[model samples]
Structure formats: structure tokens, C-alpha cells
Target: MKNYTITVNGNVYDVTVEESTGAAAPAAVSAPSPVKKEAAPAPKKAAATGAEGSVKVTAPMPGKILGVKVSAGQAVKKGEVLVVLEAMKMENEIIAPSDGTVASIHAAVGDSVEAGATLATLN
Candidate 1:
């Protein structure tokens, strides 16, 4: 029997190896236990809702919509916050791209959105 220390992907582990002189039969390996399978989650939609010619505000990444700051028909500035998103346990503020009236809000609180998914529109 021999023991060795191995480092894999920056993780260190201790391993033991047994040497055989070809005098004994190999040990049998038991069948692996059945694994539990889980149903696939529904696909995420990147749908954007707005009137034609309206500026679309999109999410930067996949996350839950934490809050909608501006309502429909509200006037906002170019750098004003439009929505709050919760991602990776952090809160992200979605800002407006230009000064405009909020034409419509497509995302609600607690809604999950994908990257580049429009959350609102401005006109």
C-alpha cells in the first residue's frame, strides 16, 4: 500500500493506492444507485412589450424585478432610475436611456426577466 498527496484545480487531496502481485481475483463493483430526475424548468421569454417607435428599456441580466420606479405616462430623465432588479443577491438599478415619457411598463415586481429583455418602453 502506498499513499500520495494530489493537487487538483488548486484543491489538495490525500489518496491511498494498493499494489497487487497478481495472486488474487479483482473485487466486484456494485451497480450504481438510481439517480433522481427532476423536471425541466419552463423556458425564459425575452419578450419586449411597447408601442412602435418607443424606446425599450431592457434588463442587463437574468433576475427578478424588485421594483418599478416609474409608472406609465410618467416623465423621466436620461439618467433616472426606472426599475430595480435583484440578481445574485444584489440589487441593481435600471436607468433610463433618454428623457421621455414612460409609455408602458412590461415587467412587474417579482417577475423574472432575461438579459436584454425589455422591462419598459418610453416615448
Candidate 2:
């Protein structure tokens, strides 16, 4: 028999495994009840500079902003890359919706964003 201790989300548990000489399955071990603890509230993000524009550019999936390709007031064409988002170990280009100037960039490089969260805007 072998014993192991593991911690998950700050909760600790003991696990045991039994060696089998044959093909039979090992017995399951029940862990002790975990203590209930209150989780801390999430921190809020500060508002970005400039007001949001008429056309919103949002994230398709939750990811970290890898790069900001355009700055405020920069002219862009339809389908131009505005930001590079890293999700699922892949880089996705967030593009502009139409030919317009970049109104504002709500998210910066390295900022963690949720799906449908605003990354930038065009006007």
C-alpha cells in the first residue's frame, strides 16, 4: 500500500493506493470532510481612458491580451488586426469591424479578459 497527501484550492486530503498482484481493481478511499471557508471578493479593474466608441470590439473567448496592435486615433480598415489574444495556447487576432479610427483601447497587454468583454472600440 502507498499513501499520498494532496492539496487543492487550499484543502488537504489523504489518498491511498494498494498494489495488486492480479487484474482486480483497488478499493476507493474516502477523504475527510473539508472545512468551509469564505472566499475573498475579486478585485475590480480601473476604467480605461476615453469613452467607449459606437462600434465595440469584444473578446470571443476568455484570454490574456498578448498585444495591442493599434493605439487610440489610429486609422484602421475593415478586418485590420487590433489586438492579439492568447487563449487555449493559441494566438487569435481581434480585428476591426469597419474602416474607422480607433476610439479607445479598454484592455492592455497582459490583462486577463472574459468572453464578450470589451477590448477596444472604433468610430
Candidate 3:
């Protein structure tokens, strides 16, 4: 049996290995203890009401808002890009549900959003 001390990303770990003479059996490895993490601060609420209109444009997946293409009170067409979200290393466009005026923008650039969360409201 041999023991080794390893450090990864400033985390220390202890490893043990057994020598085998004949049969090739899989060696058991124990993972390092999990590091303690601080809880994230709660997100602030948007100043304007998110539910501003009858039609809602929502995020398709969890991601960060890369850009907001439309502003409040702006007229938009169906399939027009309302917001650009970056998720899983890909950019996804959140489009208007129908031709209408943008009543409100619930997300801003660099804001993290969840799937199905409202991005904009159309009137």
C-alpha cells in the first residue's frame, strides 16, 4: 500500500493505492471532501411590474441575457428578436409572441434568468 498527498486548485487531498501482482481489478478512489460555499445574495426585484400585458415573452432555458433588442413602448412584429440569451455556450433569441407594442422588459443585459421566466410583455 502507498499513500500520496495531492493538491488541486488549492484544495488538499489524501490518496491511497494498493499494489496488484496478477489480476487487473479496478482501483477504488475516494473523492476529496467538498468545499464550503457561501450562499448567493438574493436578486433584487425589477422596478417595473413584469406582468404588464396580456401576452408574455419568456425565456426558453436558463441563461444570461446577452442583449435586449427591444425597449418598452416599442412596436414589435411576430418572430422579432426581443432578447438574446446565452445558454450552454449558445446564443438563443427570445422573440415576440405576436405583433404588438412592448409593454415592459423584465430582463436586462447580463441578468441571469430561469427557464420560462418572463422576459417581456406585449400589448
Task: Give the clash count for each candidate.
Answer: 0, 0, 0
| Model 2 regions more than 4 Å off | 1-41
Write down the lDDT of every candidate, Cα atoms only: 0.80, 0.86, 0.83
Q: Clashing residue pairs in candidate 2, if any?
A: none
Candidate 1, residue 64: how far the Cα is off, in Å: 0.4
Tens digits of per-residue lDDT for model 3 on 1-123? Answer: 888666665555666777777677876666656444433456686665434988988898999999999889899999999999999999998888799999989988899999999888999
The local lDDT score (0 to 100) that residue 55 gets in candidate 1 is: 90
* Model 3 residue 106 CA deviation in Å: 0.2
Top-down TM-score ranking: 2, 3, 1
Question: Each model's TM-score?
Answer: 0.59, 0.65, 0.64
Residues 1-123, model 2: lDDT tens digits: 887666667666666777778877766666555545544455678467576789999999999999999998899999999999999999999999899998888998889999999999888
Range of the 10 consecutive residues with the lowest summed lDDT in candidate 2: 32-41
The best candidate by TM-score is 2
Q: Give the lDDT ranking, best first.
A: 2, 3, 1
Candidate 3 clashes between residue pairs 3 or more apart in a chain or in different chains: none
